[model samples]
Target chain A: MAHLTYFNGRGRGEVIRMMLAAAKIPFTETFLTERQPFEKLIQDGLLPFKQVPLLKIDDMELVQTGAIVRYVAKKGGMYGADDKEATMIDMYYEASRDFYSKFLPVLFMKTEEQAVKDAKAAGEDKYFPALEKRLKETGSGYLLGTSLTMADVGFLEVLLLCVEFGGDDFLDDHSDVKQYYQRLVATPLMAEFLKSPFRKRKNDEQYIKEVKRVLNRE
Target chain B: MAHLTYFNGRGRGEVIRMMLAAAKIPFTETFLTERQPFEKLIQDGLLPFKQVPLLKIDDMELVQTGAIVRYVAKKGGMYGADDKEATMIDMYYEASRDFYSKFLPVLFMKTEEQAVKDAKAAGEDKYFPALEKRLKETGSGYLLGTSLTMADVGFLEVLLLCVEFGGDDFLDDHSDVKQYYQRLVATPLMAEFLKSPFRKRKNDEQYIKEVKRVLNRE
Candidate 1:
């Protein structure tokens, strides 16, 4: 069985978990509530980059969230069909990452008002229009082909965050993305996994405080 | 031939160019001397994320440096031969990125003293030992298999930056990496490519000031 180590929240780790769920891959978890365990993992030399979420699989421990997620996606046959399609899938995945990178930073640095403003601006100016255009252009309801690839998986994750920070009406303006998001969430695999007992909770004040305290950032 | 658009500096644009050189990919470059051309590209919908280092290939415009670099590596046979190898190659590539992200940020915001300290710490504590360990383990002088892969390419790029920021004796203690770096530099393809007239200069004050002025940052 594959194992994952991280905090008990939907930060970077959740996306990997979601990919596992999408692929129906069984995996275990090590949810560290504090910093000591994380430090110990580094001390034990299990983590090359001294970070999590680390995935232990195929007798190798992988760090770097992007590497881990892509590996899982590749192994699960979600990467794409060929080199060109794979590149496109990677491009879309990276596009979502850029959106999340710009949209979510303010949440850690300042007020909710500012965070919302940043999210809206990032979505409106950068991601929303381009993605809507691509989705409409595809007309297949999926980002690439007729089925769900890591491209859609990554986009769904960001879209969920967008709606959370910007509101449901966030996608209301981008009807194509809204319909695509709905279609992805309605997939039987995703629908069931969203309610799984192992599904982690949303990041909250307590979780943030606990993690920051452990990392000595507080 | 593919087309690349970016500033005439080895900042974010160089690595992609290096991968192209390594794979012997024939591509033309559009070196943006000012911000006007960059904004024009974005305005013309050529840049998806409102950024440069965009590559026009396969009749599609690709953004995101990582995606573009990986695509080139994949096409050039530098991305490992299989999925597992590809994952390791990506892990190594990302490790180098992590090193650069930490090592270079200080140059833009603070003193050279602090930048050196951060670069040394980032290299020694994080990248150095792990990479040395892996290199010795592989015994191939490559990050993955017996031949040059994207992992080695990525590391060589960072090692060049590491030498620039840390100095000649930086890799002295890491004997394996030092020798490997020397071997990569001596390669026939790379040796000739390094002297190409099209190679961009390293980032400097004039380039930075020109970019900022054009972008209205000042």
Candidate 2:
């Protein structure tokens, strides 16, 4: 049995949870609800790299969200079919991360309006178009092929997060991305997971409040 | 034959070059010397993510520095020895990337001094100690056991960059990390590559100039 630990947020842990659910793998999620215990875990040297989303299999504990997701994807057989597909999957995963890197910092910025504006612009102008083109070229099923892979799940998580930040119109110009996102959510396991209370438990209130404070000042 | 393309810089392409060299594999490094041609390549659809460090194997082109390094590492047989080692390698790779994430943005900030100070502090307080502990426990001479892997290569790149930013006395407190740095540089292929003109070809003039400007202001 795998024991996965993270904060009570969907920030980095959502994809891991989705991958486990998609693979029908059973794992216990230990959510750190506050900073005190998290600091204690760090002091105890239980948290490798002083971070969460650490995955423990028996005795081995692994850190780095990207590493954890890729490891889980490999174990779940959702990595990719071959070298080419894997390369594509890797490329897409990095693209999603690149997308997030643009906007995530904005939540803590003093110039939240300008930062949010830039993030939205980049998302609409660059990321969405690239995603739309890729999905169209590959067909509407998944990021790579007819079968689901980690890229699709990871990409969807990024899209959902950006959409939450950018609002519904985020995908209006890119129908393919919108449709592809719908396809991912409608997948049997994901459909069930999306409706679960787990999906609504995004503990990004601190970040959200900060962004709101900056925006209100603006 | 593999063809790697990037600026004259070791910014993101050095690891790929090092991996190929360490594995005794042959590859052609295509350095983009000018902005015009590089922009043209992006416009020509030559760059998938509109970024360089694109690895072209035969006809297929792959982008993203992380993806390229991992792929080249895989091809060069430097990924890892087993599944567990691979996970450890992955974890370390992401940790190295996380280290970069903290400092890289500092280069572009108005509060560059404070940012660099924080980055240097974290490098000393968090990253360096963790690395020293890992090195002592593994006793592998590398991050993994007995043989070199991508984690060492990637982590070395991060260390070199942070050391560059953190100044000469940065490693004074962490003798183990200092020794490890010397050890990696002494690896035959890495030693040769380090002394080569290739290592000095860092052509990120725009970024370097900007960082210098902000530091001068302080």
Task: Name the candidate that leads on TM-score.
Answer: 1
B1-218 per-residue lDDT for model 1 (tens digits): 88888777777788888888888888898877777777788788787667667888878788888889899998889988877888889888988887777656654645877777778887787788888888888988888888877788788888887787778998898888789889998877777667885566666887787667655687
Question: Among all windows of ten consecutive residues in candidate 2 chain B, which has the lowest summed lDDT?
Answer: B209-218
Where is model 1 chain B poorest over a 10-residue stretch in terms of lDDT?
B101-110
Candidate topping lDDT: 1
Q: What is the TM-score of each candidate against the true structure?
A: 0.92, 0.87
lDDT, candidate 1, A1-218, per-residue tens: 89988877777787888888887788999888787887889889888766678899889898888888889888888888887888888888988877777655644545777777777887888787778877777888887878888888888888877777777887887787788888988999888877895667667787788678656688
lDDT of 2 by residue, B1-218 (tens): 78887766566677678776776666777766656667677678777566667878746888887777777777767878666777889888888877776766653444667777877777776788789888988997788887778888877777776667777777788889888887887888888877876564433556455333422432
For candidate 1, report its TM-score: 0.92
For every candidate, the chain B TM-score is 0.93, 0.82
Model 1 pairs whose backbones collide: none
